[model samples]
Target: MADITDAEHHIVAASYHLMKALQTTKLMSSDVRGILEKLDFHLSTVVKINEDEPDGDSIRELEKSVVSSHETITSLHLSYSKVWASGPEVILEYLEAVGEVQRSIEALEGMPLSRMSNGVLEQAKTTLHMAMERLQNELIHILVQNKQCFEHEYPVFEVYPIYEESVISNEDDSVEDASLKGRSSSETEDCAMDLIHPDVVPQIKSIADTMFAAGYAQEFCLPFTAFWKDVLAEYSMILYVEQLSIEDVKRMEWKHLNSRIRKWRVAMTRIIGVYLGSAKRLFDQVLGEYDQVSIACLIEASRGPLFCLLNFGQAVLIGPHEPEWLFCLLDMYEVLADLVPDLDTLFSQETESLIRIDFHELLSQLGESVRVILKELGNRIATCTSTTPFQNGGIHPLTKYVANYILCFAEYEDTLPLLLQDQEPVRESGDEEQNMDGEADPNPACALAMYLQSLTSILEAALDEKSSLYRDSSLKHIFLMNNFHYTVEKIKNSKISPYFGDDWIRKHYVKLRQHAMYYQRTTWSSLLTFLHDDGKVGKATLKARCQHFNTAFEDLYKSQTRWVVPDPQLREDVRILASKTVIQPYRNFVRKISDSIGEKHIKYTEQELGVYIMDLLEGSSKSLSHSRKR
Candidate 1:
């Protein structure tokens, strides 16, 4: 050290300052090591110290270090995070700061910490514990913000289709258009979830993985739970919007809602599955009840979107709809069934029980819906028969409607047995006839058989009603014959007859023949009675009988023009049978009094009368005089 200039003095002072700084750094390192060693010592022997032992000072000293370390970490996190900035860099720095505090606790934890007393270790562990919590909270905030941004940018919320009066009609064109319109809306929503933020799920999983590595599996549960809550909330919100936007489901065409529900179910499964399937362990932990109430909130929150499915179920069960509604519902349930594994893989026994209850309820609702549709089909059958009574010999329009409805019944054949479990087996007079004739083989008991039985009952009742419309016994018999004949023919022509059995066909056919025979006996036998001529009768009396015959035939023919005998063969048979009854007797009588009838200006020659009668079978009546020789 020579006597130096100002620059040399400044250099000497600067060197001293550098040396002091190095000494201070060394002291700081020693202090850090001493703190770490003390932490390890406390962890190692704290539990071995009996509460009766007089070592309060060491325990207090350790507690103070833990508190101070916790405060330092809190302060550091606040200082860095106070900038309120965002992005991967900011997130990484925050994670690093939290991880630094966690590493200290992990060092202490490695030193036989199981022997540590709960009171002392709990205090020392608080720093890392709180840091993990803060880290989790920060990550959750980031996740929520990310989700909010995704929602804002993509707006994937479901938009419920509106049904103005224009689409509500039951007209063929309107229903078809409404169906297509509904499917289009569903397709639009199908893509609604396709555009989610790419970073959302992965970022959450990354944070969860970090938390798990820090021995904070429970801490990981919180943020991931929050993440899933946000995800599910979004899903529920979309469903809510969709449910609200749905028009009167009970009254409007269901095709649109049906399609919308199917699409929504698929979207729900896909979106929820995307998360649950991706991070199996994370959700499994979140779903676990490590503590009694730890996961109750998550379980309850998970059920939010499921309510929409239940709502659709409610609509399906209670609404006045057809079995087609049930078909769509089953499709939706299938989607839900596929979705269950994603969530169910995580379920605890208690949670599984809860979900099982919900499923049981849903299944019960489905069963109820099936029953309702079956009942409605029965009611519709009654309505059809009541309103469109068999008119004219053409099959009742109701019969056609019932036939088509039976065909509709075929759609639910798979499910109908379940519905009918609570119902009485359908029995009908036609079915009984089949059993009596040994044609009622035990075909596998099925919905088709039950439906046909019910339909046969309805048709039999309608035929009875139609037969009552005519006052003349013979006409009544003919009306029954026509309706029965038409019904049997339709059954034979359609796919439904096998359900009724061949003997059912034979029974109705036999009844139709009986009716025809009865009509001949009741309506035409009187004309046959007149053929029993006593030779003792005078010309005046015979002429009287001829006039009487002409009057009766004219009355009968005129009154029958309105009657419908739809079967040409049956009409021809009746006409020919009547012709034989009238013409042969008249011809014999004419032979007996040929000159007398020809001489007296009889109203119709036998040949002209026969031609006039032929017109009756053709549903037209030419006046007997129109057939008179011109």
Candidate 2:
């Protein structure tokens, strides 16, 4: 056992020494790796330095190029003051000099500035700066000299000829003509306005390229943006877009304000669609090498006028929510909606996203305003009341106002759906299926239809309340019948008929007929009872009944003749219906009673009664006393 323990201790000691030796070796290996990596890095740096060292020939060539470019820039700077006055060849030489300096600067960029001797690098930079300054001045001069005169009388709504089929059918036109013909009016307008003359674009682009190469993009943008901004402002003034605040709009009378709103529509369309679009094209043409810079330039230059137009819409949005303003709001909404695509295309860059967002928010606010105005109209109609009823049971003012208002909405059928799209339609009981047509989500048109239906229903309820002001029940029915008939007929004849649907018209027509029937029953039924016999056998009784009939008939004729049914067709229909109801029964009773009581007891022949019934609703008062054959 002692020998076995001794061997175990010896094995443990050997293993411990071996593990210590292995760890020492690993540390030594790590030190060698660190040394090797340092050696490799130093060797690579030496090789890179040797490789970057310029040869004598290349250095001489760079120096020569710099000297030549400097000479060109210095010579061009002498003529800078008269750059525009000089011929095109001088302008061309100046642009070439600017380009040569830019290229020399680019070639020097690869060399270490410290390597150049005798201030060569500094001299080159100074020469390039002077060249860029000259180029900048030349660019401004060319832009100013070539800018197209602002034509104040430019047509606001000119339809381009290429959009017409006559222009499209010409086979001799170029590819550009075909492309122009294919473009929509808005797209055509995008390129229609030229800020600078076509001859100057190439010269401007050359200067722009030189400036951009020399890292003077900001300097290039400044004058271009300023010139276009002033032009856009002038264009705004020409379009009659006044710089009015919300307070200004609020204070103006509606007549003057209406004119301004119309001008705003034209101005917004022209500025955004034409001027901004043209400016974007100019930037792309001049600074096509730098997209971000060009887009930034456009946004900065036109931000003022663009937002000026948008702020007008915002001002109108915050103005009063009167019923009369509804159409104007719709007009603004439509114009904005139409321009959204153009705005998206023009302002799609990240820098111009804020303008896009502002427009979207304005569009949303205008839509909300329209909804508020429409809801207020409904509220006004619902609460509309009168202490005095219409004198002759003609169509009520409320009905006329609402019918005309709803018909106007039909004119905006294409635009209202987008505004009303987010609203959950108010579904009266049993209208859900009709409105949704078995779909869970109703289309925008359905929502608009539902809204119109609700409005008309509110108007009907208002008319119903107003009808109670009439003291006579027959005139109340006449009032409702006339109003309902008028509303239905107006809807039936106008463009809004589809939104109300055939079912709605048919149902209202039924209601109108019911009111007519009510008028007949209430007015003529009582008078009809006089003609009926109650089993009286004596001739005196018959003669007394005949005299009572004549007196009641004459009184009814006098009072109701003055009442009106303004619609001629409706008037004829009402008369014919009364004739069928009262005239035949009246003729029979008069004929039967006249045989027993003699001709003197019967005051009116059936022919005379027919004539009187025909004149019942003619809106005139007449007396039969003079014409009575006593």
Q: How high is each candidate's TM-score? A: 0.54, 0.79
Could you give the C-alpha RMSD of every candidate to the true structure, in order shown?
12.1, 20.8
Worst 10 residues of 2 by lDDT: 174-183
Q: After superposing candidate 2, which stretches have Cα over 4 Å from the reference? A: 1-92, 105-126, 149-192, 434-441, 533-537
Candidate 1: tens digits of C-alpha lDDT, residues 110-131: 4443333345465546556666
Instruction: Find the candidate with the highest TM-score and give its number.
Output: 2
Residue pairs in clash, model 2: none
Q: In terms of lDDT, which candidate is strongest?
A: 2
